[model samples]
Target: MDRLTAETKIAELTKRIERHNRLYYEEDRPEISDQEYDQLVRDLQELEAKFPDLAKEDSPTRRVGGQPLPFFEKVVHKTPMLSLGNAFSEEDLRDFDRRVRQAVGNQTVRYVGELKIDGLAVSLRYDNGVFVQGATRGDGTTGEDITQNLRTIRSIPLRLTRPVSLEVRGEAYMSKGAFERLNKEREEKGEALFANPRNSAAGSLRQLDPKIAASRQLDTFIYGIGELQGETVESHSEGLALLEELGFAVNPERRVFDNIDDVIAFIASWTEKRPSLPYEIDGMVIKVDSYAQQEELGFTAKSPRWAIAYKFPAEEAVTVLEGIEVSVGRTGAVTPTALLKPVSLAGTTVKRASLHNEDIIREKGLLIGDHVVVKKAGDIIPEIIAVLPERRTGDETPFSMPTHCPECGSELVRLEDEVALRCINPMCPALIREGMIHFVSRTAMNIDGLGEKVVAQLFNDGIIHSVADLYYLHQQRDVLLGMERMGEKSVDNLLAAIEASKQNSLERVLFGLGIRLVGAKAARVIAEHFGTMDAIMQASEEEFTQIDEIGPKMAASLVNYFAQPQAKAVIERLKAAGVNMEYKGLRVEAGEDLPFAGKTIVLTGTLSQMSRQEAEEAIARLGGKVTGSVSKKTDLVIAGEKAGSKLEKAEKLGVAVMDEAGFLQVLEGNG
Candidate 1:
């Protein structure tokens, strides 16, 4: 291509890459798959290399992508945390091996290979063997200090075996099991679910509350070092050993090889065994073991010269889009799933793939009989990635989302600003079953022995129809024991769990009801505000809107839900069954003499003693309004460590500033 064409392409690529970087790094929501994103970066790099004169110093390819989140304190690394170049094929790995050999004067190089975990990268610093601070890889030079959240990960050691000051790098991740359980809980609570385990882990770690992080079962694996003091480790494998000795969790599957052939073989073997692992591994990272060899290999502008990630090809299989099937979720959202011709993908039989929604089907131009490209998303969810229009026959039938609920025949409505079509009928059988499942979920009602499988079995057998029926199961103990997988001990345990759920806080009951737009947080807030189930049921939309976080939409949802006879009947049955619905959680009501009375406050950066949520709650109790962003209306800006642009903006606006100690003093009415 000519220089002008290259220049235009470079500008386009730069804009696209920056957008993707913001989505993937800052937002933790990526539009494209990692492989597709890599291809884009590769294209940009090739163009820049061909036309060096058009290349900009601030190109996305030249620097780390993320920036520190404003919620946490900023941490500057002693050594830059650089990303690695990717190797997609065997030939790519061979080329990488050739470069390493050539750069190191044709010397035999020993390499260490570790699984590339699909999770957030973090840096943990230790001072005198005591874990001091932990931070996210927000760009390479700077990060968000999340020490409190990092401490919650049981795998991360608080103190090392030796009193040595060092900085170590690792990947913080949620196991697939943990992710599934979390998602199940979220679904039950009427919350938007995370896409994958990686997203779940990243979101969990980035939470402003350490308590929230602690609730999520997060794990970590230390792979390398950033900087070390009083330590002598010559090779990558040796460094991992030292980290493991210091009580850090290290991946046991890592192998050391003298040649690239063995590394390639090891990578190949994982393709079949990948699904068996408990966590997610998107690829394999190969690094030259010797520190001396690594130094000699030098570095690229963005990646280390000694390391390359061999990304496994996303497993894809072509299958016929046999039919479109619609299912109603707990929230009554009608989701269209693609019923595909059975095919093998990623070592599993793939009979169905997610079509997502009507927009996707229309965008992909998919038809009932069209040949579609199917792939497992994160090697778990089967999804139709694309359609082969050329392979489409004239007999292919186009599909559309249903106009009415398939289960209850209720008129479906598409909410404003949402692509999903939802059924509004509260008594729909599918909705009732889903609601019953949610009511007994671990987080909602804490019914230990009653899982989704058991809930389905009970629902299918017509033994339990609603949440209230679960509470009355004691009378049907004999019938429960007659069911499959139900013994005397199990039935007794389940009944005991159901009875115990009756005494839970009103928030749990509110969440268990599966009201639209009412998640766990909202349920807690609303429950606290109303104090009783009756109060909430009788609350007007205007009263609901007066609450701290409730808006008109949520207020309307609550009013409409309570107005339903079906929901009201269930609540009556639950109440009749002796279920408690009064808010039992701690609440500090606002007082006239409170220090923060009638003040609007904004919190910036990380608070050491309390989480962002706790601070906000405290402020609210003192009759303070906590608003996002700094403005002239903001009465005070509580600045903590590494206060960012909000602090500066508050200063510019002449808003009063208070440190953590001062804020605590104000909370105690001693300021």
Candidate 2:
């Protein structure tokens, strides 16, 4: 066929494919089977490959993803992404309606009520119809670059039907069914479970490996348009229509109401009806129907005055905690667990709830035989609500804190107001094993292919008691190779990954330490504050508390941790082994010209370039903080491919937004 004829054929195929994409993703109706869609995609790929010079950026094949990213840099949004103020009750909804009316002069308007998805928020940027980048809603101003990761999400279009440079905002969520399956997989593999669907979505999105993120099978729904370079829409509804036309998956449940009463009724209906759907809805977002009214209402420091989130009642279930039993952690923290007689909750079987500490057990007057109420706090973790003494039997035994670590028989010590007993025994075998496990965890040392079984085998063989011991394992290469299921190639790969881990950021090192109450976020804070092991050791408790999120308890823990002779020795050995315990050697993403520079960022979705750790470092290099969640304090949110609830929160907070290429441009100062 001649060039003109081929071009004509290509245009026709593109339109057909776009229609199919609309049917499958946007409409949830697949006119063709998966096999047929693949054929269409393949045909487009062949045409594009055959005519590389003529291949349009906006061709349907662009969404398939490009080469893996070297690292997600940082993106700055042209406009600040903002959040919506939330209303928990009918009265609060009325107040929101009144505020809007007062701001817009009560024109008697329509409103858009959308389900508040429990997922990460993402911003997609396209240039001339080609999917260019994706990012998380970091702080309203900046987000980690995740263009490559977003490409892996099959639902998101990589290329558009027509040439246009646009930014679209959407929610990337892990459905309830997916969350349950993921948690089940984790449980079967003896990994810690995600507390809820939101966390599952979050955890999946933040995967440093795009392949891993893709395997998690994330889904998304486009809710709003951000900065559109071409075309025009007068109302938010029109924008939604345009998105649908462009092969975007807009939420089907959205309703437009003419009055607040109708809006209230809609919210009321969804509050009960939402659970019947596949996804989880925390609330209903009420937005002014008229774009004109939205602009007039403007925004507050953290939220948009034109919009408010009316929260639905949380899914709750009441179950009796029959007794409290102590379970030992890998770190030797004896968590007192409330034993419930196997009640169904949160779509799964709930046998127990974590009591957190001996203090909580005591505070609740939790007895061994007491009938106590249990609830999933935040609809995430099962928590002991209160002890029902009235339901307690005379045979109930008074709960007492353990004097020794149950796992390794180490002495348990009490920290004031901590109600939890800590095993300060650094040499405890269980502690060592668990610490080693954490050391190789993805968010920490990130040693691939080294699982619990391998770690246990190493421990049992007296081959890997300490993290440093892992470094020397290559010396035992022959022995390692001879082990069960271990081949020469596998051993070499494991050794290579271990060797590479020595260069991870100081935050990872701190988290891998498994200090009581010190989490991944806290670890980053400490690494930034102290800069070095020596400096952290010398810091006073008062100094420690000055850092954000470091409370009195955390400060005390840090101080006590440094004071431990074993911890000091371990740090020395770790340093000797080339561990990165200071930030001096790290590279932060240089978003020097980006609007989100000197901002905080949180990444969700599989980032294309580098690992999640590397992307975070990239953000930091650009003078931004990479955080784990979205909040009012965030300045910009660079939403990536499969961004979930964090994206919504970023929008609700009225923060700035950006996609990957935009983030890179801002980082590179071209945007």
Candidate 3:
């Protein structure tokens, strides 16, 4: 065919194929057979190959897969993906409604109830109605770019029906059938089966290879808009409708209710009907339908006051506690786990449940060979809620907390105000193994292909000792290849991932160090504040406490950790091995001259020029602390169009106020 003819044909075929994809994946109404759809795609691919210059980026053929990415780039979300406060009972739901009504005052509060899909939360951004980027909700404010992998999901449109720009939030999930099929395939290949569909979906999206995500049959349900450009949406329900009209898969299960009672009834109906659905939903999300009402209600520090997640009661099953197994964590906190007789709960086999600590065992009166009730807390973690003392036989043995470390034979000691027995011996084999595992975890060094099993194996074989040893693995290539299941390709990939992790910012390294009282957020804050490992190491406890979030305990922990000779040695080894020791993230020193420096600010209503998150980030960049509410502590409040109760509160509190124009001027250092 001629170039012009091929181009026209490609366009025709692409549109046709995308229409069928929408029908099949989004609408659950396929007009063509599987073979027919495949033929259409094949034709488009052949035509595109013939006239490569005419091929479009949004072409349906791209869904097949693309070349693997070296790493997922970090993306700062335009709007923060805040988590919802949960409601477990009717009272909680009513409490949420009462709070919403009290804030909005005399306004008819309508709520949109949506199935909270048990999947990974992702944000999708579009430019001119074309899919531009997709990202995972990493730490809310930031995310990992997964555009290529997301494009593989058929339900996600490559282009919208209208030319508009927006960022939408969705739940990327694997259907129960797809999960079963995937697990079956993995089982046949003698691979470890996924614990549940949610894990499978998350793992699929996080894969560097787009082809892997493509094969997983992942789908999405766009629930809410994060930011809309060149248009306006008055309510959440209206925004969802707009998404549907634009060829997005808005979940059809959502309902809008005027009163909390109807919402409660709707949630009650789902309790028994949840299992009938193809996808897993751990809870129902209740959100104030009107955007104005949501603005009026405002947000708390961590979550919005306008919404709450009503979690379904955990599925419970009675199982025999066969034994109690204790394991040491990276922090040397030994936790007890209940080894239970295999029973199905929440659609997964429950072989083990968390005993938490010896205190939990005593509180529950749990004994070996005793009948206990197992439930998935929040439909995620397995835990023993109750012990059936009446069903306990005389042969049941009383379980006791071990006095010594199970792996190192060191006498375990309980720290002040702590329950878990700690193996304080830094040389303990279990602590070393667990610490190494944590060092390479996703939230830490993030060295791909080095999972818990591999870390344990390496530790057992004495191939590596400390976290520093991971940086030197390239030198032990032949040794790594000699290990079971460690082929040339796997070793090469592992080494490459390890090499890539060296370039990670200082926060990851700090978190990986497994310092006491320093979590990922705390590590980020500390790293950003100090800007370098040497600075952090040299910081006094009093100096550490000067940072807003750093308390005395954490400050002391940081000071003590850096003073350790072993810790110093490991850091030196890492530095010599080319690991980045400086904070590479965006920051501006909180100088007194900066306009909003050290000021607590709140953003209200809609800004025409920038999203709310953009304003907050700008304020933060100037060393301003952007809070969610207007209070006496608030130094200023930036009120925009339709400014609500926050503005009134700011006025009442005599807090300084600025409009959008003034806010923009201040951001430019002109106000």
Most accurate candidate by TM-score: 3
TM-scores, each model vs. reference: 0.54, 0.64, 0.94
Positional deviation of 214 in candidate 2, in angstroms? 7.5
TM-score of 3: 0.94
In order of TM-score, best first, we have 3, 2, 1
Q: What does the lDDT read for residue 494 in candidate 2?
A: 81
Clashes of each: 0, 58, 0
Please give the lDDT score at residue 372 for candidate 2: 60
| Comparing 2 and 3 on TM-score, the stronger one | 3
Instruction: Indicate the TM-score of model 2.
Output: 0.64
Instruction: Residues 368-486, candidate 1: write the lDDT tens digits.
Output: 99998998765667898889989966999989888999999999999889998999787787898888888877457756577788998898899988989998899999999999989
Off by over 4 Å in 1: 1-246, 250-280, 283-315, 331-333, 343-349, 356-363, 376-381, 393-426, 517-521, 547-551, 578-580, 583-592, 598-633, 637-652, 658-671
**What does candidate 2's lDDT look like per residue over 148-247, in tens digits?**
6677676788766678788899888888887888889989999988766766776666655566676676789898878776686767888888887787
- Candidate 3 per-residue lDDT, tens place, 515-572, comes to 9989998999999998999999999999999988999999999999999999999999
Quality of model 1 by C-alpha lDDT:
0.83
Candidate 1 to truth, TM? 0.54
Q: In candidate 1, which residue pairs clash?
A: none
